[model samples]
Target: MILGYFFILGNTNCTAQSLPFLPDELTQVLESGLPKTLPSPAETGRFKKLPAGDGFVWLAESTATLKKGNKLAFSKTFDAPLKEDDVGFVAVRCRIVDADNNANEPRPGRVLIHIGDRETLRQTALYHKGTIGREWGWYFHPFRAARSLAANTGRIRLSFDVQPQRVEIEDVRLYVAPSGFDMSRLPMMEAGYQGREPDAPWRQGADARIAKYRTAPLIVRVLDPHGSTIQQADVRIRMRRHAFGFGSTFQVRLVDDISPDAIRYRQTFEELFHALVPVPALIPQHTPHAKDGNYANQLLSDLTNTLHWAHDRRLPMRG
Candidate 1:
């Protein structure tokens, strides 16, 4: 039937809304379909009750166990925006059923319907017996309705514990409230703050010093081909443990961004990457005459080879 008008945000660049995605509007239309012009227990047509047999009403009893011969399957269809957060929200709002103790407040049961890369139940449905209905049903967690949702729409699920015998459910509303988040308040990002300053330089291959004089040690931890911490954080020294790991020789450029406050004070790459430490913590200290262990000899050789390669290949080593 005709539901509420909800708009989906897609590449279409349009704002045309429709129904089924909105529950309140659909409920109104469904409730008003009969002679009384309002929804009553009898007025709910194909609004089908959950579970297979035992009449739709009894399906509210989540604890009601059944034999293999008798089972129930409760399914519903909806049009919701496809996204990361919405999936979790829908599962909570539309399909959680808890247990209830009418004497005081009611407890709910969990009914999760997982359909994706992994077909598994997400959570349990809780049902609390309230005066409103025989069973308290919460199919999914409530989610804020976006003013403009994504265009990729699909049906969400509210499945009964398939393994359990009795699947009970009461009243559930498939709808969302208006979202109150204000995206306009988000801070606008600035350019040149992402390593685009003119003072930036290239220092790649073999731990080369990038900056000098800082609040603390200016560490440069090298990352190997694999995703692991190859070097510890330090400065002005070659990492000892990191000797085992060597990455492609490339330029490690550094730049300074103009602080919004003033010119004398600028935010440099050193400040940005200050948290990064040179991997391998302590280096194997060696005498100048000891093989390649000589820091000066290795530095000189690496720099010479790099400069020669850059000159021969006409690469941008100096910036």
Candidate 2:
């Protein structure tokens, strides 16, 4: 999300203001598909209505007891078929609880979306063990519409596959945006630990520490052989690398490939980053013939080439 800043400067005074903008182009879809109230009295299926204060706190929500290999489907129909370039956004506030109430253990699950009879889009679990606690949390998923499903039909289906567990769904929301819309600009849950709020007491000290330790004043001076400063000399300072490690896993093959795309990828990586960690090609576990010397030698060659390439461009390798 882009945070807007406005600055007012004067000879002796300056002020700055931060304004956050929320886009208005997004349209909500699939509202009818969501369960408004707990399923009706006569409702009978895998999903059952659960009232508030029943081991959880929600005005009303739906709970589904899913077994291994079982699937629960929720379908919605749009007034018009989605365009091929449209983007879909999903926000689900849900939590999965094991039958034995073991919140510490990781639970495996999958969420899938099907448009008409076209291909299915798979997503990983809604919440991991680290994020899952006694309360429900929101999870966001953004997807693109495939060309085959575009203008085919107005029906969209959501499927949930869970291990033997009880899944509590507090809310589900869907939105659609134009193809070029920036998904990162969409609103999402803020992730942080305790004492991260704007008014938190710890923030003042944290900001002070950052200002004192993370930044410094830079002074450049030009001197002559006579031990006198050259007052008229021009000085330029350019940062060649970062003081901190800011890097990502890069594909080793792409560094030396002749393909146009690979060359562009390497150029972009070098332009934007100062360090890298080579992926599978240099990783020992991914080496197939670890016991044999041939594969080991090849990996060593790739590593040597990568190190030379990085060194030529002043890029540091983490591992």
Candidate 3:
């Protein structure tokens, strides 16, 4: 079927996929069809309802009829092979009944999930219901596959471990992650200002210190089998400029433009990096106060312009 143009199909009521830009390889992986599960009501069974069905069986729990641990556990196995360039995610649906409810406030226990053997606190999903009631409310958690398991070759296993708190779980499921999955932020290192300026006051010879490292060549050596150096090795070097500057989130740039009078100075990263527009002007401002903030308004304007410039070319900022 032709994309971006209306076309008629043989009464099949075909609808265009939401993400038409997905890579063809990834699209093929999705088109392979998802594993089928029966619809609700018709799909009801002992295992479907939980605690009874063998299908949604518990893998581990803190306390059981025989022995109690600090938490409850459940797991399911499925065959979903992943190929290169294919992204994956997991969606889990279950109900959690926390035993600790004080005056309608739930000090619900935590739920941990593991896709395959890779697990981290980032994969945690909550099981607390706000009201003090006996209704078994369902919670749906979606997780993106970690880089290690994004591509795979074997049965996919999803395991859930709940911290000790009087809790009961039901209606557990594991499946391929779908688009628009709300994955939590992966662990990240905060960016920092690293250059002579930030250290100038404390560094006795800051310029010399900066030059010492700046002038150091990123050397590449060529050698032969006997460990003899190749004297005339042709080499080409491409180096990125070392920079020290503050970076802000794109959301901060969405504010209304600042008054021109608030700007103290204007500068551009022009040569340091490719820019789509004039760099924002710098203004003197302080914490929680935009009036006296430095570059407070200019930064916003610059970001907005930069976004427009990139959008015009249909290019992403990272790209």
Candidate 4:
């Protein structure tokens, strides 16, 4: 299977995406001063204390087990009165770990989210990669309106119908979109080589092309803070080539792991692929590495080809 991905470099007033999982780590890579529209688990104050008044804080990655027919449930009521802004959309994150000797693979489990007396929605907490021994992944559930529920005292509940097995529940929290909030206004990310679901088709196409060809020419026109284009500008470009392997199945995963180990690999690529790298003296013609070029002439050629291609396709190629 052929995999693809791309990065975006544009001038626009855009914020970063709200990645609840270690957002601080992501923020380091992302731009600053960007708004995080998603509400935090602390904002809800649902897991503040225990009912027994023992001052036990309900932590994430809590463990639980269930028989084949048994169902496990957990719920939280909103402390502050719900406002008009909390009515449109709702999202939450959940994870489940399977521990059992009888099964070699993971199975699908049932997840029910109770919005209120009127809405009791049902969804599946699918295993990671559809396998059974150990599974972990992000689970985002979207709902229509929390306003109706908020109108009636403002409370939310979550339920899990566990399959016959040992399951460990991870951190879970709910969020409601602001009033008159439009999802389209949300900041967008360039769908990388291995994009998650709910991707923008236009971006996906552009990203796919960049991934396959492994190169694209972009004319960087600098602009003042007031949006005026500057004639003289010094621009820099960063390019990186990635290699991913898949053996078990023909399904190609882009392997966009951003862990600490992968950081060094990414950094090496960034350094090697720096567009401003001076030409090496080894080659008489100043030829760059054909595999991943850094020579000025090679870059100019790529830019020329890109401009010609864009012109042929009637795509705007602004200088």
Most accurate candidate by lDDT: 2
How accurate locally, in lDDT, is each candidate? 0.29, 0.52, 0.34, 0.34
TM-score of each: 0.24, 0.41, 0.30, 0.30
For model 4, give the 10-residue run with minimal summed lDDT. Answer: 245-254
Ranking by lDDT: 2, 4, 3, 1
What tens digits encode model 1's per-residue C-alpha lDDT throughout 1-319? 2112221111111111111133332111011111211112211111234443542333333333334321233333334433322212232222223333342333223344422211222221221111111233222233322112343233333434322223333333333333333222222111112122343333231124323321246546677679577766454665333322222223211112233432222133222221221111112222124224333364445445545544453343321
lDDT score of residue 242 within candidate 4: 29
Candidate order, TM-score descending: 2, 4, 3, 1
> Per-residue lDDT of 1-319 in model 4, one digit per residue for the tens?
1111122222111112233232111112112221122122321121222222332222222134444422344444443333422322223332333323365433333344555532332221111111111233333433334223434344444444333333333334445555444433222223222223355346878888877796556778789999999887877776433242111210001123355544564344333432221212222332334223323454446445544533453334222
Query: What range of 10 consecutive residues in model 2 has the weakest lDDT sum?
Result: 9-18
- 30-100 in candidate 3: lDDT tens per residue? 22222234222211111122334444422123332223321223334334543221234332232334433
Per-residue error for 67 in candidate 1, Å, reads: 17
Error of 4 at 244 (Å): 38
Scored by lDDT, model 3 comes in at 0.34
List clash counts for every candidate, in order: 56, 0, 20, 7
Candidate 3 off by > 4 Å: 1-72, 83-89, 101-104, 117-134, 148-162, 177-319
